[model samples]
Target: MTPDSPASIRPAELAGLDLLASAVVLVDSGGHIVYVNAAAENLLESSLKALARQQLAALFAMPQELEHIVAQAREHKFSDVRQELALERAGREALHVHIIASAMDRPDGAVLIELREIVQQMKQDREERLLDQSQVNKELIRNLAHEIKNPLGGIRGAAQLLEMELPPLHLTQLREYTQVIIKEADRLQTLVDRLLAPHRRPHIVGDVNIHEVLERVRSLILAEFPLGLTIRRDYDASLPEFRGDKEQLIQAVLNIAHNAAHALAARIEQGDAEIVFRTRVARQMTLAKVRYQLALDLHIIDNGPGIPSQIRDRIFYPLVSGRDGGSGLGLTLAQTFVQQHMGVIECESRPGLTDFRILLPLP
Candidate 1:
């Protein structure tokens, strides 16, 4: 049996290794693959037979760096701990992995390589940050709403008293001034109430079909912007129903689609604006530190001039807006509602395309 060939290794030698989630490789002193587990085969994107005879350099674009690591493992008394480094995959994109190289106890001078992707940890870290930030935002909004709520009633009542005390007939022209104050106060009260709605409102859960929610939002948007907008659907009919508040889902999607519609004013006038509602299934997804076997991906795409780079990052924050005279609470409330369902809303925008992706776990 060739010392470099791992297929000749006894089945007992492979025990417990196959069960590992991360890819593991066993190579001879010359760095010839003697054994590769199922995870390794998937990671390498090659069949067992093809991977068996592969060299470390053939597998990774940057073998010289890995070769140095293996050399350290052999020469040093203490084996090297797993370190995060970039490994090239199939002459394509770089794959980030935490790798460990240790010399095997036997005289064959083989080294065992263990690798796990670092990107998964990064994704989990990002989700945690977003969740923590969302909580902080909610607390800030609630506090601000309470502060504004107290002063608004006083302002509106004071304006009324001032108007009534004015010379009744002589001040008719100035009555318009008090009316403006009252009207503006009412408008602001409405805005503050909306800012507080997502927190104060109770979530009423029921069976929800995302397509139905999108359809409701689509019709509502079209009715409002009847002349200049076209809303398209790209749905997966096979998606199963989940428990959620249908009305809240409708409102969340509506807020996003409505904003997209309004942003398309120029395109609408040119009669070429488009908004697409896309749905698909994502497998083995993780959100909020929870690993889900499947997730529902819903993307709201717009062909408008895209979100302004300045406000893109803060669009989900209350009172942050990109347009003139915009209330800016639409996306904030939408985010709050989606978060209630344990989902996340993310956006990618450029010159012509703006895609809002909502990811929700599937039960």
Candidate 2:
């Protein structure tokens, strides 16, 4: 619907758009900005009063395509979505956004526009993919672990019997071979146990202070890298204690911190490696499609060579690692523990920076 005049557009209707997360703007047929919502004001970094009456074309680096879309939208009385538009700002870098223009039912030929950040959209998609992939990986690992576990004990027992029967004479070689088989079987048993650990462990719920958990991990990591590594804490003291398994949380955090410390080997030897444990309360946070009033945002940041690009995307998968001689199960277990507590572990890495963020819903 097109409005014949700007005065005919309803301010109350436009004000309701502020509840949306997407930036919303209304422009008349003359391409003059008529209304801007709170999200738009925040995205544009300009107050509504300052934005009103400005030329809508001025907001975009190249407005020709947007103008054509708006014209088509107005003529067809429908909505049009365009991807990857450069939103120009006065000083800051141009933002990549998806623009949706819909013809408004008004007398002045107004068009309502919605802007969504492309990066944020990609992040949401990534999170969904991670959650889905983790489920499948966990199931596969558990089944494979069980299948390997049953045969391991039989192999170990048979090797022990063979060793006992062969040592009656000068048979050192035979005994040594049996020992190797037994040792290898035992090693396989241990690996299988670790794979099934998350499923076997019981959920021991207790009041969990996130800072306390971080402190435990910090002490353990510092003990291991006593010479050059420094662990820093940035805690939000006002955060309330939540119910979770304390031991599992400790292991989850320790795995990540330990991985970071190992990655900082070069900097640690030079006496300049640092890892920061930061915690804060997130309001109106959503996890796995479930929205919470408040959640705990914990970040484990490190100053080190970033995670290897090849394994960056699949780091949480079992047997995926970046470091030499790495078991690759640390992050898999960490993710399992966090997921048990209804949280997610997300990672971002670049040269000299690797950040692991864990988001858990708070009471």
Models 1 onward score TM values of 0.80, 0.85
Error of 1 at 358 (Å): 0.3
lDDT (Cα, tens digit) per residue for candidate 2, span 22-75? 688888888788888877888888987887778877778888878887888888
Cα lDDT of model 1 by residue, 58-135, tens digit: 556567778877777876656564666676765588888878888887677888888777876665576688788889
For each of the candidates, the C-alpha root-mean-square deviation to the true structure, in angstroms, is 4.2, 3.5
Model 2, position 3: C-alpha lDDT score? 50
Instruction: Point out where model 1 deviates above 4 Å.
Output: 1-57, 70-86, 89-125, 164-174
Candidate 1 global Cα RMSD: 4.2
Off by over 4 Å in 2: 1-21, 26-41, 46-56, 77-79, 104-110, 170-173, 283-285
Give the C-alpha miss distance for residue 97 in model 1, angstroms. Answer: 4.9
